[model samples]
Target: MNKKRMLVSLVTGAILGVFCIVGASIRSGGEASTSLLFALWYNRIIMGLVIGLNISKKDLPSIIIRGAFLGLVVSFAYYASTGFTDIVSFLAGIIYGIIIEYVNFRVNK
Candidate 1:
């Protein structure tokens, strides 16, 4: 990826990481587990990387397909690592991909 794209991914991942931390803290009543926090950061970073790498200045359909596929791959890896299946996470991944792509599109433009 280009330097600009990398920078965008990093920034987006960091923003998502912060959101994950805050969400986890709230969900756990301000006592989130270290592992949970770590997972959140890791997942967001992966998603950002995948979205940044796959998306391009292309047609909307192609962009959507690429983003959705990459998102599924990342989400699958996460679920496999944790030895659990979460429908929410799976769906979230897809949504995250679209959101990331949209953000990149807006930023790049």
Candidate 2:
């Protein structure tokens, strides 16, 4: 949680966001781009690793429960972005959240 680490994470995350947007847009026609895959993969893997590393061993169950809720929240969070243009994207968030959270829980345990 140091300022330097936080800054690095923030910058990386923003960059990834850009890649996601670009990748998803171009995805309308062709096979998915490597850059887009890299962005999403990096975010999920690293973020999950970070969360797993920080979770308390004894509170694993509670932590997992919270993570589940977070996934649900993320699904809901996409409503604004996909509400008008792509309901599938919003629905995918729910699945993404679950998969990401499950991986985090497994790694952390």
**Candidate with maximal lDDT:** 1
Return the clash pairs for model 1, or none. Answer: none
| RMSD of model 1 against the true structure | 2.3
Residue 53, model 2, lDDT: 36
**Candidate 1 lDDT, tens digit per residue, 16-52?**
6677667767767888678877886789788887676
Clashing pairs in 2: none
Q: Candidate 1: misplaced stretches above 4 Å?
A: 25-32
For candidate 2, give the lDDT.
0.46
